[model samples]
Target: EGKKSLNFIEQIIEEDLQKDYKKEDLKFRFPPEPNGYLHIGHASSICLNFGLGERYDAPVNLRFDDTNPTKEEQEYVDAIKRDVEWLGFKWAKECYASDYFQQLYDWAVEMIKNGDAYVDSQTSEEIAEQKGTPTKPGIESPYRNRSVEENLDLFEKMKNGDTPERGHVLRAKIDMTAANMLMRDPVMYRCLHKNHHRTGDNWKIYPMYDWAHGQSDFIEQVSHSFCTLEFLPHRELYNWFIEKVSKPGDFEPKQREFARRNLSHTIVSKRKLLQLVEKGYVDSWDDPRMPTISGLRRRGYTPESIRKFADSIGVGKRENLIDVSHLEFCAREDLNKIAPRVMGVLDPVKLVITNYPEGEEEWLDAENNPEDESAGSRKVPFSRELYIEREDFKESANRKFFRLTLGKEVRLKNAYIIKGEDVVKDDEGKITEIHCTYDPKSKSGSGTEESLRKVKGTLHWVSVKHAIEAEIRLYDRLFTEETPDGVKDKEYLDFVNPESLKIVTGYLEPSLKDSKEQDKVQFQRIGYFCVDRDSTSAKPVFNRTVTLRDSWAK
Candidate 1:
């Protein structure tokens, strides 16, 4: 056995351990704002932190950076917890930024008294205008020189909701001419009168993410605060704020950046996803077409598949767009090993065996999953009349067509060899039924020589009388464009795939009737599918997880 190579993030930890870092001092945290459901993009961060926690046997806290009250909600907080737990990682503690509001406010007061922070009375627009670009230094607010007594009094009034929401903000008194724009007196707290989800109306002001994030990590003593690459510039401010609030000897949490993994043809932005839900583009946040963790779960994605994907891609220093096909490929691979094989025809065409007796039926032995020996077998009813895929049969086809064609032989999966003889069509020339003759001695799994005969194609079928009808929802990419967000001229919504979902009635084997919600199965030659939550005794519904192969490949 060989030791696994470390990713860049792991290498950083290893390097730190070799230097001033202690093995036991390694604590980590996954901080997410409870503004929306966790998306596929968050999956990487969750896996990385949780993976490191497992690697070092360190405590990893599930911390909510729930600073703003307007957008944050307890619903999203609960959803986030469910998502992380579903990924199979347990958090050491459930913490929230709201829990540290009082401490943070106290620290802000101390910073003000020390002249490291001040209350800025400028409107948000005016403040933004003062934040000079990359080459230019920002203009310091006139109030930046306010007396500590005046600043303290004004900030206290702001916290008490006595000021207008846009009137005042607490800013760190860092260098106004610093090269990093984020270091130029960034806002620490903003006066928001909205009620906090956890604190209720206890406090009327909220700390900015930049202010609360690093300090919360510092307070919890998290050794590494890993954030996406966009936060790279904020590391200075992150450290500075921690320095202001910490003693010289205290351990500080360092903010490190990793490139975000983007999925093609999908938007991970919560704003856009919210628009999708609000505009009726999707049913809800958990719509199967969405990339949210709940959406993927409802869409039949197994936790094992998602974790495998996150682990396989690892973490990268540079951002790259991953084709959704690879994710689908992962799902197919995982489902193949676990999903029970069943017969289903989404677009069925009736096939009547001419020589077989009309009322006769036999229960044949069918393997549940050939990939697993212990999966064993089940009885699948075979009858005179069966349904196969409409595309499987053609009155005539070229030599390349291995499926059922007139005068050609094809084996019915788990049944007998059948030769297409004739077809019955409507007056409009649409195929209504297909008639075939089966070799009785050619029953599959029988020791008879005819049963051992080879065929170019094998087609899955369900007995017409014993089959159960189901509603199948075939899912596709949400956006038609490869990079929906990259287009400058059009919005991501403009590229929404109109045919992303297609509902069809399917003929499924009788055994599937007993399948409960969330039960996954491979529909033999069709694809992988799971019983949706909408299933009932009268009508079972299935969601197509992914195609058996990538059909969209060029």
Candidate 2:
């Protein structure tokens, strides 16, 4: 039986509804910075915000927190939208912080004219020195007492590109000795004479993230502002700013924090991922081994599997590292019922069925996916010459070995049973091939008594004459450490997994000739795989997402 789907976020929404928080009044926003590609951590947030919208019958706005133009880009913005839509959620309206630049500027002016804010002349170093440690009270800035009229004029001048130095800043005139240090007169605006991606170079000033985030949510009428735990301290500052800026009875969006998802044995930091791409350590941002959403998609991960992972992890207040195996488990669960079973050999060893007639071929019926009865079956080519996994045969046999060994019997998947007669080796004593003889009466699904005989092992095989040659890329975790970002003293790069990706040539069943880019399937007894963007009609390329469960790990 399927288990119930429950997450802490859903429970919160449910209680809110029970307490008369009107369903139609609840609104959520997925506010991403768009400075980097979306990672698995962001997927959790995406599911929460959009899932709330779905449950409440409310709209979820997709807002880009494009506060820092230097780091943000149109490419990132487009990628984020693509990822969200792929995850099966639609944004009610597209929003950008740049769209409210004028309103934010007007609010800054109001603050300056009311003596609640002022233009500061302290350099960044001087400001830092004044902003003391948590154990100490901060010293007031020299310009803290500037007259309201003078401060307003200075703010306008600053906005008009009059200040080119860091000392000139517009700061909220909050307490400098507050216990919560974020309220110690945070900077509201900075003078940056840079071109904005959306607003262009019409103004030289930009609102700080702390100042713009809450008001933007207010302007959009968002009822809930969801963020990660790192922003908890800033929440107090956020609510304070919103209270002072908006009317008393107006709805102020509440800020709630949840512990961001962290996966074991994987580094999800954008900085580290960028380093891997720029330093040529990896192919690109979408490399199959990367943890980025685009990377996972390119690696053959389905959106359903990823969303299911987010739901399974649930929402929590405490932080913990989740095993990457849980993610693999979700993918396997999703693909088990969908992916068609196919035959492929990575390390091929030639097998010659001496008892079978030469230059003859037969069609053998193979179930497409035994897990799905409606999938039916397909015919596979079977012939005298076949290729099996190299590991399936042994010249020096062991007593417990169930695979093909000298004089041992084994069954070919979807074909007749065979017995290994002898093995062939080169001068270096490396086994090159195996000789076997087939029992015609033991063909699979032949409805004969011999066909029902049990064999210890069944191996997937491809006819040498009808097989398709292809390139396969196998990917592993990118990091060797459990917490690559936790150790401050050691560089994260030191934990890089050197064997993250391996590319090799392999042979697949002839049915794969029709496979195109992004098509996924399960290589029988091996793993689930996807056709890569690099696939060609002549030589298709595939990526192995994850391997099937085997007892080796046990």
Number of clashes recorded per candidate: 0, 0
What tens-digit string does per-residue lDDT give for candidate 2 at 244-363? 789977877888889988998877777677888888878888888888888889888899999999988988998889988888888889889888999999999999999999999998
Quick one: best lDDT, which candidate? 1
Question: Looking at model 2, which ten-residue stretch has the lowest summed lDDT?
Answer: 545-554
lDDT of 1 by residue, 1-554 (tens): 59889899999999999999999999999999999999999999999999999999999999999998999999999999999999899999999999999999999999999999999998999999999999998998999999999999999999899999889999999988999999999999888888888999999899998999998999999999999999988898888888899998999999999999999989988778999999999999998999999999999999999999888888999999998998999999999999999999889999999999989999999999999989999999999999999999999999999999999999999999999999999999999999999999999989899999999999999999998999999999999999998999888989999999999999999999888999999999889999899999799999999989899999
What TM-score number comes out for model 2? 0.97
Which candidate has the top score in TM-score? 1
What is the C-alpha local distance difference test score of each model?
A: 0.94, 0.88
Query: How much lDDT does candidate 1 score?
Result: 0.94
Off by over 4 Å in 2: 1-8, 18-20, 165-167, 550-554
